[model samples]
Target: MNAWICNSSDGSLISFYLMGMPFLPKSLFLPVFFIFLILYLFVITGNSLILVAVVIDSNLLKPMYFFLTNLLVLDILFTTTTIPRMLSYFLLGDQILSFPACFLQMYLFHGLSCGEAFILVVMAYDRYEAICHPLHYTVRMTPQVNIKLAAGAWLAALLIPIPAVVQSSQMAFGTMTQVVNFFCDHLAVVQASCSDSTFQTFLGFCCAMTVSFLPLLLVVLSYAHILVSILKINSKEGRSKAFSICTSHLLVVGTYYTSIIVAYVAYRADLPVDFHIMGNVVFAILTPVANPLIYTLRNKDVKAVISKFMSHWSRGYP
Candidate 1:
């Protein structure tokens, strides 16, 4: 809870220039703004519908939907932290974000992202229990148990980014407050710090990788077990059906991790800053949309329940 000391009057510790696509010509700003706005709308609307459908459809009351509901909320919040302010910058051309606001944005973005990773790992466990240990799935994934898992994910996400944010907040900026990135990302923000942020940057990187990929490792392990079990099934139909349940989730996971890898690689490489920003913007906007889209198209159970829910809602609409 650091107080913002961005004294615009003194002009010393003022706002930082969020370098959003420096080469992007002014003429294309409107088009780009609308594009991002539409994608943001899609992210919000699509995730919201899935959230509502899961809540209303009694068929979806299982542990899978319980975890999905948490995912949707995380997706919504993840973008909600940055998109509005970004849209404002696009609309008003005010790319200057106060120091405190920038840090808050960074904290929320990293925290929610870490939380989503953890949730996906938990979902992998859910799928493992359902497919590999069906007889014990009931006892393993009770509603109360799912609630606890979701709560733990949220708590961990909220708490894990604190050290990073605190260190960033305490950093002193030099006369040059212009950050060469769209938002106050960890790398971009630290670059502008006047202090020796080597330790802070290292800590953030280690924690981020650990938080993001440790769960990914668990997901892979769970899926490996799932694959073994599926292969062991004697009936072809049983194998197909069992594998189907995992496909949608695997697709979403692939896209999510691919985006993460690409963005990190682009950011770390000596490529143009535009490349890095575009990689982050495109994927960040697309991730929330990915989950609901995959769920709707790949998961028969979700589509069936959603279709039924839509029909019922339409009939009741004035």
Candidate 2:
């Protein structure tokens, strides 16, 4: 047990002590703080730029960019939910999170994560339609339909984790308040509970499958259809163009799942607790940081728009 956990005479919980980068020496905390600070700033600035580009350019008023904007908003919220507190932990050595604040963090992080997964699925479906059924793509993915799809994803994400969070909140904390990670990750908080956590663990697993793998499966199926359609194109240039359209989204998907797998493996493998902590940290930070970079580099349209936006801003245009 960590030295921070202590007995409560009345068996009630008041706060949680976050163990931020337990493996790092005290002298290195400031450096890690600065590193995370930079990444968080990048995530905010990069995603915000993409969002602004999509908003200002009438050319980007389509289903794909709409979903892209949704994704950018989710990524921004996702990082905001965890990284600021983490920076405080690293910089000021303030690891104490009030009880309600800890659960709120867990709920917001998990909810935004779920929203991003589903938004990716929607993007894949949009790509599939554009590639496999180009004639009907516009009719099928109209603005109202896109609005409904995005709203449904956000609503499901907001509601799906309520049960697990409520159940976990009711579990007996009883002074076992040392959350093993820098953030209030679902499993870490459940484990901190002094009460029975087997059911909570299982519940978290089920929710993970529902939100994570289910969306991934949908994306894979959509891409499979897209691949079949692209293969039917007679001209090599046509095929290349079709595949290029998906490259950025595919890269985003790959980065997202790679971080997830890394975190999952670090937890399930026989590794040190520090590795487990770091794995979750990677999951929290990696995709949001990489997502804008991938889209900006891989998608010519986005790159051009961002470039134009930057030039206009430099010349004092609103």
Candidate 3:
């Protein structure tokens, strides 16, 4: 009768539903979740140690490390906002997120990312001053000037994502509410909307390019000038010493920019879901984890400070 027909229609809808299926197989969930959890803890602890070391050591209180401290803090903030929620989804097999929660996560994740990009540009400029104009480094990078630059970077990062968020908020959702990835990524969420997404797509593209490419260009130009200055030094030992100081910075910048460019290209081409997720995880999590190790291993002063701090902590605990 009528009841039988209604039950049949419900069964058909469930069979055809695309949004609710698990993207990852059950067998792979627990192992991947644990690995990501361990990586997240390492990122948090390592970056926090760097920030603490910079704050306490009097000798490390220069403008260069000041910028680095801010960068480390941003990395911590960046990873914290995205990774925990992703871990939760992996552990619980639950991907249901309310509308506001998803939007907030997207805004904060991209906002911190933009802030990190701005901070990297500032760090490159700090290196440029220290290497190319050694005599004026102290004068140009004074504490007050550093404060102003840091404030400007934070403000710029926060404002750049406003247009995209506003545009996304206007889109209407039809039958789809499930996002493919673990957390609510802004691009994926926007793509799910039923309304006209042309303007949103264009705005997101422009913002991503502006935030990623512009800082990358600045970093390259600063290092070009830095290399030219380093070559002018007469002694081989002196040139090696100078290059060592900047090598860590260069490695971090290279990893960050390369991963970001790959991700952008993949996103534009409509690549597979797994590819997109992997690219973002590399840029967001792996880059931050690598920053502390690169700086500590490559810089003698940082290593000494870290050793001293660890020894003090060990003695106090014992």
TM for every model, in the order presented, reads 0.92, 0.96, 0.90
The number of the candidate with the highest TM-score is 2
Clashes of 2: 0
| lDDT of candidate 3 over 1-318, digit per residue (tens) | 011122221211211111322456778878988988998998898888888888889999998888889888888888988788768767885565665667777888889889988998999999999999999999999999999999999999988887788668666663334455566567766766655667787778788888888998999999999999999999999999989888888888887787787777666677767777666666668678888988788878778888899999989952
lDDT digits (tens) for residues 36-76 of candidate 2: 99999999999999999999999999899999999999999
lDDT of 1 by residue, 167-258 (tens): 77777774337777677788778766766778887887798789878889999999999999999999999999998988988987887898
Q: Measured by TM-score, how close is model 1 to the native structure?
A: 0.92
lDDT for model 3, please: 0.77
How large an RMSD does model 1 have? 3.5
Winner on TM-score between 1 and 2 is 2
Question: Counting only residues 3 or more apart in sequence or on different chains, how many pairs clash (N, Cα, C under 3 Å) in candidate 3?
Answer: 0
What Cα-based lDDT does every candidate model obtain?
A: 0.83, 0.90, 0.77
Q: Flag regions of model 3 displaced more than 4 Å.
A: 1-22, 268-271
Please give the lDDT score at residue 181 for candidate 1: 69
Rate residue 10 of model 3 by lDDT: 21
